[model samples]
Target: MDKYKQSLSTSTRPFSQPFCRRLMKPRINYKNISLISRFISQRGKILSRRVNKFTLKQQQLITIAIKQARILSLLPFIKFDII
Candidate 1:
């Protein structure tokens, strides 16, 4: 199907998401819970690189930071919704 072909083409392409050309790299800190929350799901799950569009290194850093934040009580391990 057209969708499947398009997905394959994109996967082969370099840099699926926009890459920063800056000399300095962005810092991933556990203390920045607000920013880290963007990479987490509503159920307190860390999103994958495919969904977040982050490079492998960045994704690893995010996962580590999220785990650290959770241990420190900055981020929650599980989210409970009030229905």
Candidate 2:
């Protein structure tokens, strides 16, 4: 392989330049069920930062929001087994 091609193949990380489009932040309100669900797993668990790519503050907000939704019966505490 040519020297230039070898360098291109080894670069996996995206450029540090700010994205043209920003990622949408999730709402902390209980009524924002749609957005909240995207940050949670099908098993009714909150997803981690690595998977969700949310900032520390955002993750904390999501955790509290999901808990509130659960308490209000807006979201499930645990998903029921189909089997």
Candidate 3:
């Protein structure tokens, strides 16, 4: 009778008892965090490489275009005074 009253006086978990055992357990997985870091690194690499490639290409094209325009504009001004 005393044991029965002791159990009754305590506050039991919402899950009664069995499920509470699993709920109170501590479990961990490190692979998920590693995967998150890998994803961010991969994305950063892709973006930086693309930006660098485009900048180089744009600089080359602009230089070539300006040289061509200068040659075209100056061609008619040259005089071959060969007597």
Candidate 4:
């Protein structure tokens, strides 16, 4: 029960209440404002989700490979960047 309540607020106490409405105004105006940046942000999110999934798949592959051989580096052998 305590954990559930804590999860509701988390670290956002400073910007709770009235400021929350103000913070959301920019997102509400995204359709009219600088459309290019919004496109970039949406694309960036899609790219990040793909990369995270790829990294998890890589870790699973590496674990299986380690079982067969003794050599596996955690660094990316394939191209991936964190945005």
Highest-lDDT candidate: 1
Backbone clashes, candidate 2? 0
Model 3 spans > 4 angstroms off: 1-54, 74-83
In the range 14-45, model 2's lDDT, one tens digit per residue, is 33322122343433667899878888898989
lDDT of each residue in 1-83, candidate 4, tens digit only? 99989888685533223223444344333133232122223323212323323344333432343232322332122334667
Which residue pairs of candidate 4 clash? none
Residue pairs with backbone overlap in model 3: none
Candidate 3 lDDT over residue span 1-83, tens digit each: 99999999884733122123243222111222332122123222212323323344333433343344335552222334556
| Candidate 2 whole-model C-alpha lDDT, 0 to 1 | 0.75
TM-scores of all predicted structures: 0.73, 0.65, 0.24, 0.21
The global C-alpha lDDT for each of the candidates, from Candidate 1 onward, is 0.80, 0.75, 0.33, 0.34
Once superposed on the true structure, which residue ranges of model 2 sit more than 4 Å away at CA?
1-26
Pairs that collide, model 1: none
| Structural RMSD, model 3 | 30.0
Worst 10 residues of 2 by lDDT: 15-24
Instruction: Score candidate 1 by TM-score against the native.
Output: 0.73
